[model samples]
Target: MANMNTLAPHVSGSTFGQVIIDTIADLRDRRAQRAVYRRVYNELSAMGPRELADIGISRNNIAEIAKQSAYGL
Candidate 1:
């Protein structure tokens, strides 16, 4: 006779719990990064051509710079 516990696949309680924790952490991190990106983009966009040039950033590259600042990529 097969034991019921042996017949069923084993599922670990800790693994499941860890997965939930990791997911929540990942979501929180993304949200924070998004906030950083938005702030950088908005601040850069508000500057005029001369101001941007003084800082060595071009208006056309504002979005890319914000992305790099927030995501490091």
Candidate 2:
């Protein structure tokens, strides 16, 4: 017969609950990151073309720039 091993106290439902909480936190972080991206994009897009040109960021690269601004990766 195979021995049934019990999970340690830390690995039990308490841990499961913590994992769920961690997942929620991670999701919130991602949501906030996306929000940052959107906000940056909108703000940048509102600038006149000459202003954007002065900054050297093209209109096409706004999304990528926003993502980088949000995540730094």
TM values, all candidates: 0.78, 0.75
- Ten contiguous residues minimizing lDDT sum, candidate 1: 5-14
- Global lDDT of each model? 0.87, 0.86
Backbone Cα, N, C clashes tallied per candidate: 0, 0
lDDT of 2 by residue, 2-69 (tens): 97435334445567667778778989999999999999999999998999999998999998999899
The true-versus-predicted C-alpha distance at residue 21 of model 2, in Å, is: 0.8
Per-residue lDDT for 38 in model 2?
Answer: 92
Clashes of 1: 0
